[model samples]
Target: MDYKDLRKEYLKHRLDPASLHADPMIQFKLWFDEALQAKVDEPNAMVCASVSAEGKPSSRYVLLKELKEDQFIFFTNYHSRKGIELFETKFCSLVFYWRELERQIRIEGIAEKCSAAYSDEYFNSRPHGSKLSSIVSPQSSKIESKEYLESELKRISGMDASEIKRPEHWGGIGIRANYIEFWQGRQDRFHDRVCYTKTESGAWEISLLAP
Candidate 1:
């Protein structure tokens, strides 16, 4: 099979700089709403990339829990590899690709932990099984076997729901974006790219890039 032969043209939509919102957050919401209307699966899923202190980079897909006026939020274990890296570097990138819509968004930002109150609120709202899993799972850590995890999960599940409070090791991390780029695929590979960069004076500078 020829791998290079498995390409398809992307002509579903076009992005215009003039049509973008002055506020990147608002623009993101507009596109996010369109994605929802288009029935894009897991539209809030994004690839989060972080680098360790020694410059080793790692990336994984995570759900975008909440989008705030100043930042994008996602939750995870504080001791996880990505969490540790994010806290150490305080810099990360997020990528969202919606194949069904032939669009993508890239964001570079600073990482910060969300407030404990917010974390607790979100945790309490989660499903019971998810809550148990969060309490028992030592994410990114090696364990003896699957049985160990199952046992731990079972143990946690047996406890009273009210007793299962949010662990201090698990919570939300917010990314304050300094740069964001929106990409819309087009015919003949001449895609459209619009970039928003935050300036030192707290203003956004928009620009177009050649595709």
Candidate 2:
């Protein structure tokens, strides 16, 4: 199969500033609502990108837990590579790709750890097994075998739910976006790219880019 032939057919939507909400967050909410209505699988999933102090880039899939006026929130282990990188540099990027809609959202921003109280609130809302897993696994760490993890999980499984707490190394990070770009696929590779950036005066300026 020719890899280049795997082109997207994007008759589903088009993005124009005139049709967009004045606030990017509002636009995001519109798209998110559409995704939900379409019943796309794992619609909350997004790609998070981080760069280390030494300039090494890493990215992974993470669930988008919340979206606030100025920031997007997700949880992670503070000691993980991405977490540590964000700690040091306080910057990251997130990408949401919904193939069913042939659309993507890219955001770049500064990251900061969310309040511990906020972490606890979300932690307590997780399933029992998920809470135990968060407490048991040292995320991104090298372990001996699956049995080691299973045993640890089993040990904690018997504990009372009230005894469970958010791990000290686990919490949430919120990315306050300085730039956001929305992409819509088009026929013959004539994709559309629209960008919104925050200016020094704390207002969003929108523009189009060649794609």
Candidate 3:
């Protein structure tokens, strides 16, 4: 199969800077609500890009667990590669795509560890199986075999949910955005992008970018 020519034209909607909310987070919530209304599959799924101290980059998909104040939140094992990378460089970029809506959201920000209390609260609310898996697996670590992981899972399966506590190495991280860009695909690939930058006085400066 030939690979170089693959492409799709975006014929969805136009994004206008003047119509966006003054607060980027509020604007984000509004777009997110539309994604939900459009019934986009896994709408909360987002790609998080992190850079190592050596300038190498890694990207992966993580579900957006929560959005609070001016931040976007997600959870994972603190020992994971992304976690360690963020520990070294306290920042990351997030990309959220709602294909059905032909829209995308990009965020750049500082990632901070959320309060232990908040992590515990969300951890407790997770489904029982997810709670068990978090306890059984050492995320991003090499394992001898799949059997070993299954055995560990089996070993912990009998434990009551109340007895299983959120592991010390697992928790939530929140990203307080410094910049956000919203992209809406338009006819003939003439997409519209509106970027919001945080001003020194705590205001947002919105701009339209040539697409």
Using TM-score as the measure, the top candidate is: 1
lDDT of 1 at 36: 98
Cα TM-score of candidate 3: 0.96
**lDDT, candidates in the order shown:** 0.94, 0.90, 0.92
Instruction: List TM-score per model, in order.
Output: 0.98, 0.96, 0.96
Better of 1 and 2 by lDDT: 1
Scored by lDDT, the top model is 1
Task: Show where candidate 2 strays beyond 4 Å.
Answer: none
lDDT of 2 by residue, 19-51 (tens): 888788888899899999988899989999999
Ranking by lDDT: 1, 3, 2
Residue range with the least summed lDDT across 10 consecutive positions in model 1: 152-161
- Model 1 pairs in collision: none
Off by over 4 Å in 3: none
Each candidate's clash count: 0, 0, 0
lDDT string for model 3 (43-152, tens) is 99999999999999999999998999888999999899999998789889999999999999999999999989999999999999999899888889998888988998
